[model samples]
Structure formats: C-alpha cells, structure tokens
Target: MTEDYAALVRDDRVHTMLYRDPAIFDDEMERIFKQAWIWVGHDSELPGANSFKTAHVGRQPVIVTRDKAGAVHVLLNRCRHRAASVCERKKGKASVFVCPYHGWSYDVDGGLRKVPFADGYREPVDKADHSLIALRTECYNGMIFATFDDAIMPLAEWLGPARKWIDLFMKQGAGFGVKTLGEHRFRFPGNWKIQLENTTDAYHFPIVHKTFLSSLDEDTENLMDVLGQGGWVEDLGNGHSVMVMIPDLIDLEENLDAPIPDRFAALAAELAAEGHDDDQVRRIVRAVGGSGFNLNLFPNVACSMAFFRVLRPVAVNETEIQHIAIGMDGGPEAANRARLRLHEHFQGPMGFGTPDDAEGWERVQRGAAAGDALWVMLNRGVDAPDGRPEPGHEAGDVSAETGMRAAYQMWKRMMTA
Candidate 1:
C-alpha cells in the first residue's frame, strides 16, 4: 500500500488518490473484491436448465450457469486449454461451452466433455485435472453470489445484518420473486468504489439531481423532504448499508388504490384494468413500482428504485455499470410494462438521472487529480443535530453523509484486512 493510501482515509475524510491511482486500484481488486461475496446474477437470469450468464468477480470472468440436473455453478470462463474463453455470449442456454480456439468442451456442470482428435494426445490426457475451475456459489432468496475464497463465510452469513434488508428489498416483488427485465449498460471514467459510495449517499440527491426532480410532476420541494420525512441512513455491517425510507412512504403496501399520486395518474387505469382488487392492486403496484430503499450490497449491487445498479471495475479510472429493472415474474403485463417505463424514465442512459450521475462521477475523477487538497470530506453528520447514534450502528438525516462514512469504514476494513 502507498503512504497516501492510509493517509487518505481518516475518520472523517479520504484523500484524492484513492480514486485516481492505478496501483491502489489493483490493490483493492486483490484485497477487497477477491475475498468478498460478490453478487453475480439473480437466479432468475438463468431460469432454465443450462442457462448461463457471463459475469465478473474481481476482474475474473466467470460463467454463472444452471446445469441440466438443476444445480448451479460458477465456472471460470477461461478454457482449460490455451486460455481461450469457452463461452462467448453474454447469456443464453447452452448444453456445453466449446473452446473457440481448439474445440475442447465442457458440460454445463463444468466437466470436461471432449477433446477433439483424441489420438493427438500422447499420454492419457488427465481429464480429471482439466475441467473448468469453479468458484463457490450460494444464494438467498433469488439473488446469487459467488466468491473466489471457498473458505470465506457463506453468502447468507456474510450479508450479516443486511439479510433482513434483503428480505425487505425482495418483498417489492411480493410472493413472486423478482425477475430481470433486461438492463442498460454504460461506462464511466471513474473508479468503481465511487459508484458504490454514490448509491447510499442520499446527501447528493437534492444538489446533484435538482434539475431532474424539478422536472417531475411531484412537488419538488417536499420531494426532497421525503429523504427527511421518515428515512434514516444505516450501516448494515460488512460493507452493506441502506438509506431506509421507513414507514415506506414510497413502498407499495402503503400506496395501493389510494388515489394514485398525481404524478402517476396516467398509470392508474392500467393498474385498475389488471383485474386486481384494491389490495391486489397495491401489491401489484408496489412490486412493479419498485417500492423499496436503496440497498448497497458491499462491492456491487445497489437496490434503488425500480432497478439495481451493478458496478464492474474495468480499470483504475474506468467503471462499467448496469441498470437492471425488476418486476414480478408472473405478474400482469400492464403492471410489468409500467415497471419497465419507470425504470427507463429514471435510470437508463437517456433517462432523467443516470447521465447526470455519469458526469458527476467523471467530474469527481477529474477533480481528484487537480488540486493539492489532502482530504475529501465525509464529515457531514459527525455529531449533534446532524448525527444520531443507534444500536449496533449510527444514523443521520436522509441527506446526511452517514452512508458514505459507513461505506468507507467498510472499505478500509476490506482493503486493509
């Protein structure tokens, strides 16, 4: 670690090089991401047997697949022969992954299936030693996570106090587990941790998204106040945290057919015609409307609004993010359509919010290299009126910097440990 690394992270501030230094970024990939339980894909993504999705765990390409026997596997994408990628597609159903370089193939369970032209081998090619490498995988609800360190704690245990929050989050899908409604992928010239910190950092919403809010139908003034109304930021331990909107003013269970908010009046008829009773309507709306808090699950996966923002670190100063919308798998088509629209309105590349965030993160990366400032402040709510200590953790106003402080505290732990 560089002298700047420790000097950068203090109790209330961090230095600029934390985001701009290539060497430091490499260290983070090894020390933090490699050992952490990273959310790779939702089980819903690989719905059928032999279904697979290509994903990353700490810069390593892996294939998360469901075998014919219904068991799930997280296998390295690298071919056992010549280091070529056996699977090329981002995701789809495949009986086996065939190496493009030499036709060496592996089954969905990651067993070496064939080596073309068998006579070419002099010795009995030790097939047992050459199957694709697999990482340990586990799931909670429908979300799947994988880790390179097989000895690390299981995913459920690792989620720590964040488990109940996951339960609360998945409830947005009601009894029907949420399914992916596709995604919008984009890259930003910024570090992945910057995006991670941004998710639970409610303090920036009012200032950074001011123009976006004012354009919406809701009362912009009170809209910002929603962050203050009943919400509190909480650190959920093990790098996970939440900006909880308690009493769930925005969640579905509370909103129901109670005269739809004026902003979503256009969506009311569609909700009604779905043939659901009032309570049913509420659940439908809540599930599809993506009524929940912002859940930052450590290294990746941010449950925000109608979508999950997934971050992939491509380089020291480059990050690729995916915006994934969710809705009940077997739910009404109209409600699902509405979910997709809402996801697009606020989160997609051309939407009301994401582009602005892109620019903001890029700005942070650029700014870090400019000045000689030794510390970037995360001291918004350190004491008194701004900060409120709670059981097992701390709390603050929705617009407070409590979440950033919590995330950094976790970051320091992972990067140091």
Candidate 2:
C-alpha cells in the first residue's frame, strides 16, 4: 500500500485504505511527518532557560529544551547506551536530563554534560559522540518546529503566504504576542488525516455543529446561517492552506460579554499615544488577531482563530489530538479566562463541537475498516475562484476545495518522492 499511494489516491477523492492501511501509515510517519517541519511547541511554552517539553515528531520521541544560554534545541530523547529515553517527563524545568537506565546525563543544550563512571570505560567514549542525536530545529514568530531531514526547506520559505495569517494571529496581543493557555488531549479511533481534513471543512459546520450554532443569539445565528452558505478555501503555498468564514465572526460586537482584556486596553493606550482614535482601537480589538482565518500548517499544525490544534498520529486507525486555547501574553486575566471558556465550549472533550466531530471521525474509521469504500468525495467547491486578494469575502465563498487539494498534493509529493 505504501509503494503505490499514487495509484490508491483518487484524483478528486482518496480511498478508505488510505485511512486504514498500516503500511501507508508507516510510510506517512517517515515520508510526510518526519520529512516536514512538524510544530513541536510554542516558544512561550518553554520561556525559561531550563524549561523543556517532550514531543513526538512522527513516531520519534523528541525533547525540546532551552539551554542556559537561552538557545532552544530539539534532540532525540533516546540515550546513547541501551537506547533508553533520557527524559520521561512531559514538561518541566531541568538543568540536565539523565538517562534512568545508565545515568548518562545531558545538559539542556543536548551536550553530554556528565557520565556516572567515566574512569571504568575501556574504550574512549567521547562525550561529544555520545550526546543525544540532534534534529534540525527552527522558529518562526515564536513557534518552534523540528524536522528529521536536514534537507527540508526553511520554515519561512515553506510558510509562504501562510505567514501573513500567522502574523495576524500573533497581532492579537498588544505587542507581547500569543501564548498557549492550556491543552485538552484526546484519542480518536480514526486516522490522523480524517481530523486534518475536517479542520478546513466549512461544509460540516451547519450540519455537524448545528446544535451549537443554534444556541447562539439571533445575530450569531444569522452569522451561522451565512457561514452555512459556504466559505472561501485557499492554497497558501507549500502544504499550508486556509478556510475562512466571512465578516470575521469574532469581529461582531454583539457578544462582548467578556470583560475588556487588559492587553486590549494597553494596546489601545499605545495606539492613542501614537495618535490613534477610539474607533481605531475598537477595530483593532475586534479583529481578534485575524479572527477570520482558519490557518493550517501542513502535516500536523493548525491555528483556528484563537485556538490551536496539534495532530499526532498514533497508528493506522488511531490519532491523538491536542486542542489548545491561546491567550494574550499579558492580557486581562478575565479575558484569558473567557477565551478558555470559549475553547471549552467547542473544543473540550465534552464540548458542543468536538464530541460531534470526533463521533463523525470515528464512524469514518469504522466504515473504512470494511475495505470496500472506494472514494470519500471531496468535490465541494472545486470550481470556485481561489481566495487571494478579496480577504473577508473569501470566508463567504462556497466553491473552494483548494485547501484540501493542496494538502493531498503535498502528501502525494512526499509519498512519491
């Protein structure tokens, strides 16, 4: 199945085996996830010099750490002796990581800092040679990513037009930038691709999230009705793409129940000092850091307005998803709490939106196990104009499968490379 993904993948749709085949899943781990720039975590997650987090780049365990000098590094978590993991913790501040197996110690910079019994060694064990394997790491706008393949393109070049959307999301906080509030994780009994495709799928909103949408007030419902009409999808180059809903739902002031965020006030004051008026401040706040964009970073990262979705593939039929709510760096505590509540409303395990989506994805997995379903149709908005210069209207446009197609195209390129 891995050998002939091109033959298996339909031009307009993909076969069910793509989701159920173990061989294809293995190939994906190697060809797609490892080769691409997989987002490890945000820089804010490890702000202190000794802060660190454990992440998986595809199936490979990785440690993302900041050295005493403040340089961030991504290294394989395996120990040199017997291949034991050097760090078992998920996240914490540590001066050094020691292999529980042989007490092989490594500094935060991934250099071999010490060895338990160096005098007993017969053959000379160079500390440099025994250090943890390092992967190519890069950061863009404070987002950290690592790749197994050093030949891969730089994050900036790979991001292309998608960088603009990232900038917009970053602009939410006055000048401090965005931070991950917290994450809710869950396993879906389905392939990772199923969830990735759903992120940009505007078609599913009215039907799948109908109950949640209906719960909103009349104005919000009107906006939902328009959203149900369909929206613009664009190919942001590389494997990145976007599915935008028009008029920027977050921009509407009808539901400003949350207290004004202190960051917003600070930004407003800064703008005022720079000679801006109240209306300009309001407009800036209304944008909600690019409230209109559902930006997708190819392979495994997605930033949907105020929240983030990180995809982790566990196996052929199982995927783990992490939903993170973002907040302003120094924003009002109340506003950040409101953002968390809003995230919980939709993305939490028992939330109004995620449960339904997870159910749908699980059903897809179950159905695909039959091995007879040949095509999962993705022909929605295949002929629509690609959203480019039109900005907000792109979110309202219906005929746009550009995002999905872009992802699949990248998949094909990587698989066949």
Candidate 3:
C-alpha cells in the first residue's frame, strides 16, 4: 500500500520513518527530485563555450555542458548506444565525448557526432534520434537547474518569492559577479533532509558550532551570535525560506560607507594600497565577508551564508553534501584570498562547523533507529510570545524550525500529487 505522506508530515512534526524508510526515499527520488527543477551547476562553472560539468538530478547522473554556441544543456551522462558514460571528468572544456566502451562520439550539445565502424550497421543510424537524452533546463541568476518533467512550471514561476533573496545573496559578487572557486564534498550516515533542515536551523548553530564561535575574534564572535540578533526567518513561497542571521548585513551594498570591521581592517588597507578608492575597498571587503542570511531553496540547494550547500541522497541512511565556496569572478586577488580564508575557517573540510554539523546529523539518524513510531518534533516556533507573529516576522524568530516545517509541507504536497 502506498503510504499517506500527508499523515506522515504534520504541521509541527514528522514521522521518524521519513528519515529511515527506503521506500520513502525512493518515492522522493521519483516524485520530488524528478518532478522539481533540481539545481545542477552554476553559469560560472561552465566558464565559456564547450565547457562542461557532471552533476546528479536525484540518482540519475547528468552532464551539464555549454555548447560552442554558448547555450547550456543538461544531458544524460549515459551514451545513447551502449549506456556507457560518455564523459567522467568532473569538469573541463571538451568539444566531444567518446564512450570508452564502444568509441561512440558525442558533441558538446549532446548531438551524436560519430559511431565507430558505422558500416557494420544494417540500418543508417539517425544522429538526431541517437543524441544524448536532454532534459528541460533553465537558470536564474547564475544557478542552473534541470527537470525530467517538461510539463512542470517554468523555473522562475516555481522560484516565486525566493528570487528576491537569491538576488540579495548574489550581491556578494560586489559588482564583479559571483563565481565558484571550489567545493568540499563529504558524506555522512544520515538522511538528506537532515542537512537540508540545517540550512535555516539557527537553534543548533550556537550549540553545535561553539568551537567555531570561540575561534573567532571578540568583535566577530559577537557578530556571529545569530540567535540573539533581532533577525528573523521568513517563509518564501514554494517551500523556500530565508533565515536572516545578521540584519545589518542583509544587503551588502546598502552600508558601503559603514566602518570596516577590525578583522577586515588590514585587508581594507591592503586594497586601498592596491589603488582602490575608499568606496571600492569598502564594497570589496563587505562582499568578502558574504551575506548575512541562509536562503534554503527547496529540495536540494541552499545559499548558506558564505557558500552554497548542496545535498545529494545516496541512500535511505546516507547523504553526500557539497559546500561550494564562491568568490568574485574577476575581482582582486587579495579580496578573493580573504574570502577563501574565511570559508576555510568555518565551512572547510577540517573546519569547526561542518564536522560538528555532520556529527549532529549522524546522531539524529542513529537515534531514529531506536524508535519505530516516534516523531521528529518541529514545534519550536509554532507559538510566538504573544501568540501572534511579530510585525514583519511571519515565520518566527531566528532559531525557529519554521523553515523545516515549510520544506516538509512541500514534500507532502509533491509526494501525494
């Protein structure tokens, strides 16, 4: 019998089975991932014509390529002939992909270029019919997404209210434009939604990342106190949410004249010495620090403060995460260096934050095995101080579980549809 997904996901809690059930995970791969526009890659990753990168849309592997004509395409990685993967390198500029199994060649646009020993075929192989299977692809800002369901709504309409927050998040480019510098990929024994829940989860930040906060300078440590700040979380429609951790840093360009922080003071001086004016130095410095909010896009990707958090489900009890560090595309070297250093300090592989978060997610999965009927409580912000939302805060305070609740509701909607 098909499970009732709506019953499993309530307004304030979700069944533990949602995390531990293989059936539910498989259903999610088909219903949520295949039907929704899954984030595949960034425009910057495919720097120019003929560049490509490999990514996963749920469990199906796909190749994201920019053709010689500069158009982007997401094609099935498997060869049209023998099902062998046509290309395996992580990313690079490639004009043609040759399958190692049978030496079938394909173009950057996934058009079948040549088949080895074509004369051996009894029938003429139609190149148009044999090209790599392509999916419906779309991009917003620099984020690329693909979907198997061509009937689904356009990406922009699906994004809806989330676009505003995405625009603010991209302003970290500081007018130079945002580009991917690198990424850290790690796996933990836990459900993907656990890490998804972590994106907008402020309640666990202080407790889990205590060491990271302690490592920060005094002034910066105070600034990292996200829960105590007057910031709040808002439920952007379509299951997306934004957790504003530092209200003052919400719009990086708004406070260009603000005094530079003590930590960045030296960097600011360095930029000025490099011939940048006071205004340019301030803009670059502020951008290097990243935005103040974590915008969790539904299902797979998140703009988490300084980096992009992407989750891929390996199994019912396994999930792989990518913490993609972004920097100014053509900005000064010193500024990008500072941004990389800051990213390394907290979000890197050996950094203080990710390890702690992975531990917490693993523990949650371990504990889920203990009880068969227990529910994962998500009632933190169900009721406000006065039993009503604050003036501008319809979701809740910074530490609320409103974001997770929003995600599960969308999950229920998709799974039942």
lDDT of each: 0.78, 0.77, 0.90
The TM-score measured for candidate 2 stands at 0.88
Taking every candidate in turn, the Cα RMSD to the unseen true structure, in Å, is 2.9, 4.8, 1.9
| Residue pairs in candidate 1 whose N, alpha carbon or C atoms collide under 3 angstroms | none
> Highest lDDT, which number?
3
TM-score of structure candidate 3:
0.97
Which ten contiguous residues of candidate 2 have the minimum total lDDT?
249-258
Clashes of 3: 0
In order of appearance, the predictions have TM-scores of 0.92, 0.88, 0.97
Deviation of model 2 at 342, angstroms: 0.9
Write model 1 residue lDDT over 1-417, tens digit each, in one string.
354455568878887778888998898888777888888998789999989999999899999999888788999999988999887799999998999988999998888999999788898668889999988999987888888887888888888887776777777776677888899999999998789888877767777877777777655246444456657667777777777653454445555646555555555566677566667766665565564478788888877756778999999999999998888888777777888877787786898888989999999888888877666888766652233434443334665566677777777887766
Displacement of the residue 83 alpha carbon in candidate 2, Å: 1.6
Worst 10 residues of 3 by lDDT: 384-393
Better of 2 and 3 by TM-score: 3
lDDT of 3 by residue, 1-417 (tens): 599888999989999999999999999999999999999998999999999999999999999999878889999999998799988899998899999999999998889999989999999799999999999999999999999999999999999989998999999999999999999899999999999999979989889999999999998999999887777777776788888899998999998888899999999999999999988999999999999999999999999888999999989999999999999999999999998888888885698888999999999999999988899998887765211247776546888888888888899999999
lDDT of 2 by residue, 1-417 (tens): 327778666546777778888998998998998899999999888978899999999988899999878788999999887899988898999998988988988888788887888878896679888889998999988889999889998988888888877776676554547878889899899999998888787777889999888776665567556354345678887768887775444233333444445535665566567664665455445544336557888989897866778999999899999997787786555445656776787786899889999999999999887757577766555555364324444432643556777788788888989
